[model samples]
Target: MRRESETCTYWSELIAYLYGELSADERSEFERHLLACAICREELSGFERTRAFVRTWKARAEEAAVGLPAISLGSAPNQPQWRQALAALREFFALSPAWLRVTSAVATLVVCALAALAVAHAELRVSSEGVAFRTGIFKRPPAQTKAASSEPLYTQEEMERIVAERIAAARAQMLDRIQSEQLATREQAQSMPHPSPAQASAQQPDFEHRVRRSEQAAVALARDDDAPRLSDLLSEISD
Candidate 1:
């Protein structure tokens, strides 16, 4: 009986008592209370386990869909591939994960549509002017949803943070590439120490010629910078 009480209090009410987020007292209470309540203890254990399973379900779903490049939304007659896929997903030979995404996407679409229908349904019950103030789905410039223009914007700090994160990632990648190239260069220099003794004597004379060529190329680049269109550089170079 003591063991069962300990599990119950910990299991069933512990999560919900989190009250969306747990209060200090609620948290303290749950921690202490679970020790005595077996049912709640089991419920909490089950809930945590269930949450982990749900997380795995999503990860698995993403993996299955990863290789599926976005299907052509081209003038292909079937534009509602999502809807069709949603309907037919269960039959696909793909693993259970893809099916889960299809199910989730379908449910999300349905919920959005139903919510829209409900709003429109309510609005229609009371006959108002032709222009409903609802969010417009049309991009036709004349058909404006002016309310959207008034929507609250993200703060400047949020935008800066996002940009900073991107810049940091790029900098990190640049550093890695620089380090890798530097390592490769050191290794190459070490491996050939002085090239082969026979080739070293033959190639030593060509070093000055290559240096002169590189200097000429630099002068040519400086000259072209003033005259060349970007498109000229992109012209296909046939080997």
Candidate 2:
């Protein structure tokens, strides 16, 4: 009965013994038991066989890892040409310098921004009033006080000068508006109360306590009432 119990106990540790994981005294005791026990010796042999099989599998995995280039060369049949090309392109991009990637991203964003601005600035309308040309960024197209005539009244140079003047004036107005808004924001920020050092130190723990209290309150409310969940309230608001 004792030998049966020991066998049962040490059955789980057979692999550990086979792999030399047992301490020196434990291993010595197990070895002495092995000499007397046929069942333990058979179990140890089975564990040794399993270990040898795992080592063989590991050696094959290492060989496969080392032979990946050859495998890829021979197995081009599995993947489509476009998929392979895309994978190659992805690998190339992955290896690109950080600065190059950043510059590419910035250039793409700038192009998109410029394109959006150009679309916004362009105005094309065909109505009973007649077609008009309006492409200025900030200023409205000049109104025609005089009736439209086939003959050109203003020379190209005069038109260019007028457009330039309008652009300059519009730019100045925009700059003034921006500066005023910035000044107002700065003044408002300055007027706002700032916490003292003592208040600042106390605020962190107070803020955390308030958050915990709010969470507890919410949980209590949820448990007390069969009211709609917070998610449902949010979804209703969104709708």
Candidate 3:
């Protein structure tokens, strides 16, 4: 009983394992569990025996159906094909587990119900008006149409104004988004490590070199008669 309780969780897997339906990892795991589980071992043994018995029974039934001498009354025919099929079907269900039998019964009932509905010319419709079901030999006319909503529709100018307002709102949203992104980027930049003095100096253009270039440009400009001298400009600015 303890073993049965322990095996309750694994019972479904046991069937799959027996039928080689489990994947590689699952098969390995179950096999390892089986080695330690006496309940599972015993269950597997019983299942094997039952399967063998069923196979033997099935073979015998088939042989009997084919090879057995049909004792018949004068002019009476052998068993019908349907009887054989029914027998086979019965055997199949008999061999199946309870769940399969219940499922088959449920499926059969559903099929029969659907077939009955089809034969009855059933029709179902759902609309704003309401749900409707019809069943008859002849087709029924469509239901009355629902009344349109009382709300007024927008005119062309109203639609254009609405579109313009939407565009403005969208543009404002884009601008706000851009501003937020710029702030975030600036904050991120500030959060990062500051450059070392040497690194900073290396990155900056040479101030003395820039001054020399400016002086050279000023001299060139001074040589041009049309341009004012740097000295004169400085004196003028000082004055």
Candidate 4:
């Protein structure tokens, strides 16, 4: 189990190295390891054999395709020329493992994308400024001069005038609010029923009498702290 796990670790590395997928430093490092590791060396040899077998299979497939006699389209109505070519291509790769096939497909796609980009004159740049990607007959419009702002600029005097106007408007709004509150209060008061002159005169004596009695009780309580209680005031008032 331990040996198997250790070999498995180098499995991907071996494949990458075989496919020329590793960078210079990684490839150098892997080559040094490969020389010392018996398991990796053995696995690498096995892979090389498999790769050679696949290549031979592909060559034979191509030869078989070439050796085939050209037949009229009507003679083989079910198998089209394009279908035959596709079948030949499939047969060519069929000997290779699934991983190898997938890797080849992906590598081919990447190569095609890069080729398209090169043909299109695609440019990609990264710097402190920012990442920029541009393609095809693109001239970066001469770094536009900071466009003069379209907004109207105010002079110091104009700015002061605007601030003064804003302050005046705020004051006006506050005055309007105060006026509305006062008007609402006045309207509310006017809506309420008012006592007549006779009613006012009648309540006035009782109100004044109550005030005089409260003042006298307060004075007595101040003069005698012992009589501070309301019950004492009530007794005095009763008397």
Residue 63, candidate 4: C-alpha displacement in angstroms: 0.7
Off by over 4 Å in 4: 1-8, 68-239
* Regions of candidate 3 where Cα sits further than 4 Å from its true position: 1-9, 21-102, 137-239
lDDT of 2 at 194: 83
Tens-digit lDDT track of model 3 for 1-239: 13353436677798799899999999999999888887778767766655654554455466677997534334222456455445546655654567788999999999998998899888999999999988876777789999998865875456557756765576567556655655665576568678799975874565445545555655554455455544455446556
TM-score of every candidate:
0.24, 0.25, 0.31, 0.28
lDDT of each: 0.54, 0.61, 0.66, 0.65
**Measured by TM-score, how close is model 2 to the native structure?**
0.25
Model 3 CA RMSD to the hidden true structure, in angstroms: 34.3
lDDT of 2 by residue, 96-154 (tens): 34566789889999999779769778676788999975665777778879866987677
lDDT per residue (tens digit) for residues 1-239 in model 4: 12452435666677789899999999999998888787778767755655544544454466667896443333233554455556546644653456668999999999999999999899999999999999986655677688889775875456656656765576567556655655665576567578899986776786566556555654553454443544444446656
Q: Which residue segments of model 1 deviate by more than 4 Å?
A: 1-13, 17-20, 68-239
Candidate 3 lDDT: 0.66
Query: Which candidate leads the pack in TM-score?
Result: 3
Worst 10 residues of 4 by lDDT: 69-78
Who is ahead in TM-score, 1 or 3? Answer: 3
The predicted structure with the larger lDDT, 2 or 4, is: 4
C-alpha lDDT of residue 61 in model 1: 53
